[model samples]
Target chain A: MIWAVALSAGALVASGAYLALSRDALRAVVGVSLIGAGANLVVLSAGRLDAVMPAFVPEGASRLADGAANPLPQALVLTAIVIGFSLTCFALALVMTIRQRVGDTDSTGLRAAEPPAGADGLPAFPDDER
Target chain B: MNADLTSLVVVAPLLVPLAAAVASTVSAGRPRVQQAIGLGGAILLLGSALVLARAVAAAGQVRTALGGWDAPFAIEFVADGVGASLVVLAAVMGLTALLFQQDDTDPAPASPAFVPLVHAFLAGACGAFLTGDLFNLYVWFEVVLIASLGLLVLGKERRHLDGALTYFVLNVVGTLFVLVGVALVYAATGHLNYVAIAHATMADPYRVLPFVAVLSVGFLVKAGAFPLFAWLPATYHTLPAPALALFAALGTKVGVYALLRTGGAVFPTVAPLMSDLLGWVAVGTMVTGVLGAAYHWDIRRILAFHSISQVGYILLGIALGTPGGAQGALVFALHHSLVKGSLFLIAALVCREAGSYDLRHIGGLSSARPWLAALFLLQALSLVGIPPLSGFWAKFLVVRETLVLGHVVWAATALAVGALTLYSMLKIWLEAFWRAHPREDWQPPPGARPASAIAAAGLAAVTTAFGLWPEPVLRFTFMAATVLHTRP
Candidate 1:
């Protein structure tokens, strides 16, 4: 079970890296989301898996059973889920705006803020006689 | 008045900004109300920060654990001289950014969103500085990422979206990288608290080394170090003058602070590879950043590149790992925040007054706005590490320590970068202010106010003050350096 989970997490991360190399903003966003899911899995798997009982203690009991699961990773994974969700929402909204602005999701056309290369342009200025 | 009150003061830098942000949301339609909340909360925050610094000074460290649980098991905050002094720095930047925001007028209808976003950025900055938990730092980074992107994309312009998107995507990925490292470390060490982790790392240095290195790379990306800093120059140039100034002051330095807190705390685990890893990285970062700056003609882009270059100096000091090295890093960071922030703010004003940030067009501002010209020259020369300026002392300490550590190549690269930095600054000076007004009758942008000049000059004056009376800041940095532990 641990091996299966670890392999899947590794797969998710590898695929996410592959997807993140594309120019489509949506794909990039999905790539990040996949990475986030992989991260959550990694965190969840960090805890021990051989557990016969849930993480709990009866009323008036001072300690948990010896074979109980490590609960910290569960809590940490839950936090990551919520944080990752918000981050995805932000990234999606940014892509939405990017689409609305440029009318395309491709990042190739989004160079308005950067200056053109000296070789590709006439000059940096209009008055220069090239 | 009591322990609880004192603890509250320690957390107030985080609270005041968060509260202002929440309150501003309620009064979302009224810019004035939002402004009042931002400015008022910042003043209170500044006061609390001063108290926190004093408390941390009088004591060794201040820890605040919520819900009364043991530290590693509960939500916790710890502040030493480094964190507390950082709080003071954030508050100062917050207030000055607020001042600039007052004069910052946009063409669109007055939206309360600006102040709330600014408040949120401050909240994240202050929280990240104070939090002891690695997970909590990730939360604060998210807070900063969302709000700062919200600020960046406030304009519906295509360029704004482009820049904001790039910034958002890259930073979220960086945050996830940090999370992976944090989780792996937790898996190995069974603790998330700094104190606990320090103990664990000491027991098994080899186990902690790889994870800590991953975390360091995560922070280096966020800090805009070499090979990952393209996004900074890309997005930062898109912000308005005032907002750029705010981010210029607080953004990358927050990452630097995290690097210091985490890197310095785990120096033992990271030592074997630190020199080879960070030394070359620092040199490449400084050289690449300066080279980028030297190629840029747009004033904002130049300063953005300079920001990346300046971060290299700080990282070099950190990579050196000596008392003098750490002192130099802290002092340089403090000076860079004010100097870089003031420089960007000055760029905004110059862009407005000259009708262009393109150096090819704008000129002869010295003949008219001599005071603004003088402000630019002073800040620019200071950035160049000219004598008797804050940057000079910062560079002196850093280079002296680097040479002492026998990294002659790094020392030479740093000095050479200083010369290039001066050349870039002079390029701005010659074109933007000295040569000739690009057009004979340039006018300031409509709704441009004089308050930005006053606010910028105020920050510049503080930077100058650091230069003139270097003792107090030097002492503070030395204290901060010692707090990280004396050579393990």
Candidate 2:
């Protein structure tokens, strides 16, 4: 079980990195979300998965059972998931805004902030330069 | 202070800003009310931070477990001297940024969320400084990340959208790296609290080196170190003067503080193994950052690159991994925060008076606005590490430490960076203040308020005061460094 989880997490991360390096802005955002999910899985697998009992103490007992699952990783993963979801939403929204405003979705084409060099090899100023 | 009072004081720096965020959001439509609430909250946060710093100074450290839970189970908020001082720095920057923004004419149009997001950013920064758990630190970092992204997009300009896209993507990846690092650390040590991790790692440092490396790389990305700082200059130029000042002051310093805490304090045994590599990274950051600054003509981009270079000096101090090195890092962080914040604010004033952020187009400020010129000169000299200023003393300590450790090449690189830093400052002076304005008909803006100048002046005064009377800050950072070196 551990081997399966680890291998899947590794694959997710590898594919995410590949997509994130793409020139398409939207694909890069999706790739970031994929990497975030893969990281969440890594956090989840940090706690052993073979526990027989739930992470609970018996009635009136003082402590959790020996084979009980660890609850901390679950809580951490929950927080990570929430943060990742919000960030992905924000990134997607930002990409949409970029598309509407800049009229391009290529990550390499988003040089409105730092314009490319002019024909003379000097830094070019955009029309709306501050 | 009593336990309850101490706990309240320990957490107040975080809660004050958060409460202000909520209040500001509720009063969003009314810019006046939001400004009032924001400034009032910042003042209260400063007060609380002072109290916390005082209590921690007296007791060496003050801590509390949330909801009255014990240390190992509940999340912890621990404020030693280092954390307390940083909290104080955040409060000061928050107050200054709010003051600078209050009466500015260049407000973010139609953006009622700006003030709330600033408060949220402050809250996250304070939380990161105070949290004792690694996972909690990651959470605080996300809070900072989300808030910063919101701030970057508040203006909704095309450049803002472009910049925010890169900032959001890069910083999210950095935070995910931190998440994986946290997970690995917890798996190895079975604990997330700093004290517990320290104890666990002390037994077998070699086993945890890879995890520490991952965490350090994540933080280095956030700190805008070499080869990972493309997002910094790409995005920071998109911010308004006030927001830029706040980000310049607190954003990367938080990452540097994290590096110090983990490397210099939590995992001392592993630190030695990593010090050589970090030292070289520091050199690379310094050289590359200065070179980038030299190539830029935009005042904001130049200062942004300088921010990266100054961070290299602080990282050098951390990379040294000695008591003296930590002391130098803490001192440099504080000094750089004040000086760089003032420099960005002064740049805004220059834009207001001269009509452009491009240095090539704006000039004659010395003849037109003498007082502003004087302020810029003082702050610029401080940045260049001239005599009797805060930067000189900061560089003195770090370079002296490096030389003492027989790393002559590192020390020489630091000094050479200082010279190149001076060159960049001179470029700003020659282009913006001394040379003639490109357009003969250019005139200063009308109805400009004194508030921005006063804000810049206030920060310059603090920097000058610290330079003149370096004993108190020096002693405070010394004690803070001691606290960091010894395990709880």
Candidate 3:
């Protein structure tokens, strides 16, 4: 169980780092989604993995029974998934708009939109510009 | 009645803004109706916050387990003095920003998205303040990020687009870190509620290091602390005037509040070292931000860089971890919100009268618009810690507290930062207002209304009002500090 948890966390972290460093905006979004998924799995897997059945135990079942899967993580995972999904959707929409207007999806291209450092003087007159 | 009122105070601040947001979304086709509903909701939240602060002050502390779920199992709405005070701050800033929004005469039709987005951000701020569950806090953070992103890009300007994209990416990274922290905390202890996690950590302090590190990174990014605040200046400068003021007023403060809550309550033992780290970061943030401001000639960008610098001082106050430090931090936080909000609004007023926020293009507006200049001077001096203004008192408190701790270096650094702040303020004044007027063709954008100028003046008045009679804010700040400093 520990091995499984560690593997998921490792994959999540790797994907997250890759996505963070990626130039493609869409891939970065995907990376974040993967990271969220991995974090959820790590949380859910932390509980006892040997539950003989679902958490609904019969009468007299010890609350701390060794094999019972903790329900808390399950609840938490559901919340995380919903929030993660919404964020991805919003991020994707933003990426779409950027592609439509800015004519590029690369993060490098996006940097071109930034104003020149300290280019803050008077607006030039139309006649002066020529 | 006061104790029972705690839940009402906590829930109403969140619900009112949400309900207003929903109503505004439905009525977005009608700009007037949308403004009415949104402004009404904000005003109510502010009123509710004041009442809540009063009740919390009389009662000391109050907790209501949400949905009757009991401490560990159910979510909680805990209102001690600190939480209540922040609610009031958020509400006031929300209403003030709404006033600016209402008066904006840009023929650019109101976004189909603005009112609802503001509503969501308001709810998220209140939710972040009131929630007792660590994961619940994460939920609110995402809510705020979504709402803010939507609002940030509503106008679809070239600059807004650029700022929003950068802001979005950085915040998403911050949220991911928070998720990692929450997951680890849940794993280390089977509890997600803050109180329960506090208990769990008390029993097994050695096991929670990874979780703590993850959580701190997330909150620090949101708060725009040193090293992680790369997105703030670019993004904040691009937001439209009212939205910019709101961001300046609330965004980083939320992160600071979260840090304070977590550092003081759930992880008290590690706070001294964490605060020391925060103190160093504050110094770095201040110096870097001020240097950036010096390099910029655009009025808006200069102010934007200074926001990053001023945030450092608040962090310094919190880093001390002493009661005096917390008190000073609270005072500084509230003072910054008003003065910063006012200052940003003043910039908007300048943009209204002067055609541009670029310092070189703007000039001689003081003679043309003395009232606007008066408002600008008031907020600027307040921000620079001029005597009898709110900013001065806040700086005095932070400096005194640092000296009390015998941290002469931090005290001196903070004082030096204050002087640098003055330099930047003077830079704006000289270039934007005192320079010779531009060509006759160069004028403020048409439809820049007197209403917005009045709104700017109104905000300036509020800043002065607080400065003149800070006893009320000071009392609340003291109560909040006492609550945090005293362990139950």
DockQ metric for all predictions = 0.37, 0.45, 0.36
**Each prediction's whole-model lDDT (CA):** 0.81, 0.88, 0.78
Cα TM-score per model: 0.95, 0.97, 0.94
Best to worst by TM-score, what's the order? 2, 1, 3
Clashing pairs in 3: A51-A67
What does candidate 3's lDDT look like per residue over B107-160, in tens digits? 233576877887798889888888888888888888888889887777665555
On TM-score, the candidate that comes out on top is: 2
What is the per-candidate TM-score for chain B? 0.96, 0.98, 0.95
Model 3 chain B is weakest, by summed lDDT over 10 consecutive residues, at B101-110
Ranking by DockQ: 2, 1, 3
Clashing residue pairs in candidate 1 (N, C-alpha, C atoms within 3 angstroms)? B363-B436, B363-B437, B364-B436
User: Comparing candidate 1 with candidate 3, which one achieves the higher TM-score?
Assistant: 1
Off by over 4 Å in 3: A48-52, A57-66, A118-130, B2-5, B105-108, B203-206, B440-450
Strongest candidate by lDDT: 2
Cα lDDT tens digits, model 2, A1-130, are 9899888899889999898999999999999999998999989977877875788999999999789999889999999999999898988888888888878789787776676532111121222433
lDDT of 1: 0.81
lDDT of 2 at A18: 91
TM-score per candidate for chain A alone: 0.85, 0.86, 0.77
DockQ of 2: 0.45
